[model samples]
Target chain A: MKLFSLEYGLFLLSVFYIFYLLPHRHQWKLLLAASLGFYMITVPLYVVVPFTICMVSYVAGLLIENTGRNEWKKAIFIMSLMVNIGILIFFKYVDFLTKSFFMALGALQSHFFQGSAFIAAPSPFNILVPLGISYITFQGIGYTIEIYRGNHRAEKNMGLFFTYLMFFPKIYSGPIERAHHFLPQLHERKTLDYELVSDGLKLIVWGLFKKLIIAERLSKVIDIVFQNPDHYAGIPLIFASVIFLVQLYADFSGYTDIAIGSANVLGFKLTANFNFPLIARSTTELWRRWHISLSTWFFEYVYNPIAIAKREWNQWAVIYASLVTFLILGLWHGASWKFVVFGLLQGVVLSAEFLTKKFRKIISSKLPEVVNNCIGVMFTVLFFSFSLLFFKAGNFSDAAMMARHYFIFTGDESRIYSLFQAFKLSGVLKLTFLAGLLLAVEYLDRNFDLKKVISRQAVVLRWLIYYMVIFAILTFGKFQQEQFIYFKF
Target chain B: MTDADVLKQVNEIFIDVLDNESIVLKRETVAKDVEEWDSLTHIQLIVTVEKHFKIKFTAAEILKFRDVGHFCDEIIRKLGAS
Candidate 1:
């Protein structure tokens, strides 16, 4: 079920009522049941996939923890990793792998015996990849690794572990909560807090405004230009590409806000996934802010180990590790070359930033502080927005086509005219105004507690502001029930 | 060497690697306390500390340091063992 839908609202309402009615000790059981019900409702038969992986990791964790011999612990660790990773590969990458294999074979056959149909193209394996398999398996793998590393003890309670993996709020698209951080919270007794619930409700409304009013409306404009890249060029293509990045940020961060807000209402805290990534002054800072959980996951698990092992290579070690880590991170997004390119662009930019750190600092020192900040923000936004062309495109070639068409502007009124013709001028202005309002709110929110400020105001004034927000959402919010973009990952 | 001496030496390494002589590290200081000490610079710090102290750290050990105090404690323990 869609998190933004009425059905989910009803479901959450039922759970909220029953949840507080139960004793704190039994709260976990209700959460587990709710998670299982959510999974079954959403993906039906594929519920077994996460269950099987969770079972493997759970058993593997116990075995590794119990084993005294280092060799035995290592064996169990590798075996469990293989089982978890193997299942993920089969489910997520089978089609991509099969297609690549068939293409290679076709090329080989043509080279050997002249061009022909070459035994007919194999039908695509239209596999039903289980929802949240990437996230679920990664969490499981992270848990097992932590246990094996002795960083954390294996949870004896199977139910709690399962609940951690399948927790309804974050399972769909994750803040990929680590076992060490999350398991301890599950053990705590939580009482209802008015502040927590109030904050959560505010967050939910804010998330809805971002997703419906900003992201959904922006996606409509992006779709026209991106879906038919051949029909448009110049300013329109650039506008669509830049807006696609904003749309993605709104949609994904909106989903995260709702996920975190819902979990908070239940007295469970998930990690904050975004930190105003658009304002990041550099690529390195951007990664730190954007998809924080995923980037940190890769940094901790993937990058650190590789960097440490190859430390003898000095800065080159970091460069190599970063590239490999981002490549894998990209593949984690999708089993496609386009995602790989998207990831490589980030890695390359990050490496460039790293290499030129001293030089850039020197240059910034020479420039006025305002000029430096402006240049940094402009460069970061332009580079990141353009790179997302790879992410938004249907495939690799389309992305390349868009990139090429970005610079091919016709010096005519038609180019600007086509964009206006495609999207109404008044609608564009409204979205622009809304986007500007979002930025202003975010900037203010970053510096101060917006909620607290609003609360401290006079009752009438506070209610007026609240009603205005509610009215804006009610009037402008698109109730199209558009799926969050990150859900596909 | 005393823990104070170890902290002093580690402070020098941080200043040298990060290119900021004005950096001040306390026992409770964490990576977030220092603007330059990100994940990338973190490896550089580790490498520099290892080289300066002539000690090796396992991946887990490297990752386990919660703060500057823990880092200093590890160095002291390694020095005593050696």
Candidate 2:
């Protein structure tokens, strides 16, 4: 069930009710059943994919922990990695691989044999990848890696291990909880805390506001422009590109908020996935703040080993590792060449930033502090927005067209007016205002815990603020229920 | 070498690799406490420490070190073992 739906709300309510009714020790049993039930209901037959991962990872963790011989442990680790990664690659990329193979063969035939009879491309099987397979695979692998590294002990309890992997709240899109962070919590005796639950409810409301009010409203316009880049250019295209970036952030972060909030209500703390990434002054800094869980995952597992192994190459090791890690990260996003280009663009920019650190520092020092900060924010935002075109486009050619058209500023002010007309004036104005308000609050929240500040306010004011938020959401929020953008990854 | 000696050496390596002479490391110091000691510079410091001590660390050992003190203790333990 979609997390935002009435059914999911009822389901969570039922689970939460039974969850606390059960004894603390038996709570895991309820969670395990709920997780499995949730997954089964969400993807029916494809539940086997995550079930298989949990089994493999569970057995591998025990095997790695029990094995004394380093070589045996290493062998088991490699095999487990291969199995998890293999499953991910097969389901995610087989179609892309098949299409590319046939295209290459067709090109070779036309060059050598004059296309004696042009080979027709076969129809795709259109395999349905399991929901949250990427998150599942990464979660399983992260757990196994921790065990293999001797950083954490393997849980002997199969039920708890399964529950850890299949936890319903985060099973869809994860902050990718680490074994060490999440496992111990299962054993704790959780007493219902009214304050924590209230906080969680507020967070859920805030998440709903972002998704429905801002993201969905903007998505209507962004989708139109992105779907037909050739239909319009200049200002409309530029406007969509800039706001599509924002829409993506709102949608994905909104989902993350709900995931984390639900977990909090259940007395489980999932890792925070975002910090206000919009204000980041550099692409490198942006990554450190954005999609923090995944970025940390890559840094910990992928970048560290590669960089350390090639440390004899000095700074070249860092550069090489950054490129390879981001490339893999790009491929991890989807089975498209456009994603590869998007990822490489990030890699190239990061590498250049690293190489020019001294020069940039000198230049920035020459400017006023406020001016320097403004310039840095603008550059990072534009760079990110440009790269996102590649990520958003249907294919490489579409992305290239959008990029080419971006620079053609038709000097037509009507283009903006037409966009406003298409979006409807009130909708566009609401989106603009909400987007700004979200950024301003995020900036302030970073310096001070705004939630805590609100909690300390008079009961009347607090409730009034909450009511206003709920009122705004109900009145202005889109009910179309767009799926979260990161769900595909 | 004693743990204190190893800590001293590690501090120097951090200063050199990060190119920040003002970096002062304590037993409780973590990566975030030092401005330049990020994941990228972290590897540089680790490699520098290995080269300076003529010792190597396994991936597991590197990953397991919780803080500067844990790191120094591991280095001293390795030195004593050798």
> Best-fitting candidate, measured by DockQ?
1
Models, CA RMSD each:
1.9, 2.3
What does DockQ give for each predicted structure? 0.63, 0.60
Question: Can you list the residue pairs that collide in candidate 1?
Answer: none
- Per-residue lDDT over A297-318 for candidate 1, one digit per residue giving the tens place of the 0 to 100 score: 8998899999988887878888
TM-score for each of the candidates: 0.96, 0.94
Best-matching candidate per TM-score = 1
**lDDT for residue A379 in candidate 2, whole number 0-100:** 89
lDDT tens per residue, model 2, B1-82? 6677787888888877776789989999999898767877777788788888888998778878899998888888788887
lDDT of 2 by residue, A4-31 (tens): 7778778888987888888998999999
Local distance difference test values of all predictions, in order: 0.88, 0.86
Error of 1 at A292 (Å): 0.8
Docking class of 2: medium
Deviation (Å) of A341 in candidate 2: 1.3
Question: What fraction of the native alpha-carbon contacts across the interface, defined at 8 angstroms, is recovered by model 2?
Answer: 0.55
Give stretches of model 2 more than 4 Å off. A109-122, A232-235, A410-428, B1-9, B77-82
- Prediction 2 global C-alpha lDDT: 0.86
